[model samples]
Target: MTPTAAPVLIVEDDRNVLDITSFVLESAGYPVLTAMNAEEALLVLAGHPEVGLILTDVNMPGQMDGIDLVRRLRESGNPVRCVVVSGDALHAADRLGDLAPFLAKPYDRRSLLGAVQAALVA
Candidate 1:
């Protein structure tokens, strides 16, 4: 799917990260939806069927982290794609496996945009 085909839901607890991510995606011409945590992300997911991708922070402060959120979505057969962003890149693969691409924190603009584009297309 193209980046603009559907809105990208960004799940981040950090205010600055959320703002930066949203700005970057918006500037890149992709529509964005923001959620401060996993619960909010789930709520947004329930409300917005047009969402195509979920870009989430791995270590969010909620009943479920990003990994858990993605797993839940998978278990429920949600087809929406996802990308997990985290500072701890080492364990991301083991924790998330093939569920989604893992983007390390401090990712550059080009890398972030590339990952998002790849995820959307995949």
Candidate 2:
């Protein structure tokens, strides 16, 4: 039998967004891990190094914002792909350049899934 695919981590402060993201990705055949903040996300990542992708919202409440998380993870040379989602379009877009791919809030489900696929490839 084939092993299951790696889980996709969804880190968004909004419960609804998290739920919907998890639902969408899981429905598309990927397992899901959900966290509300960057710190919790880091904890999840520490335990699940096999996670294939991280979908995070930039304006999370706490010390480590999404951009910081992306930078840190990339610096550590982890293979986990990242996609930063935020309402601060320009600001977040600027920060994602070297860190990872990104998607804006209110994005279409197709776009979200597309980003997930691409980030996983990154």
Top model number, TM-score: 1
lDDT value for candidate 1?
0.91
Per-residue CA lDDT of model 2 for 67-94, tens digit only, reads 8988888788887888899989899998
lDDT tens digits, residues 1-122, model 1?
34466999999999998999999998888899999999999999999999989999999897999999999999999999999999989887689988889999988889999999999888
Name the TM-score of candidate 1.
0.95
Off by more than 4 A, model 2: 1-4
Model 1 clash tally, residue pairs: 0
Please report how far candidate 2 places residue 39 from its true position, in Å.
0.6
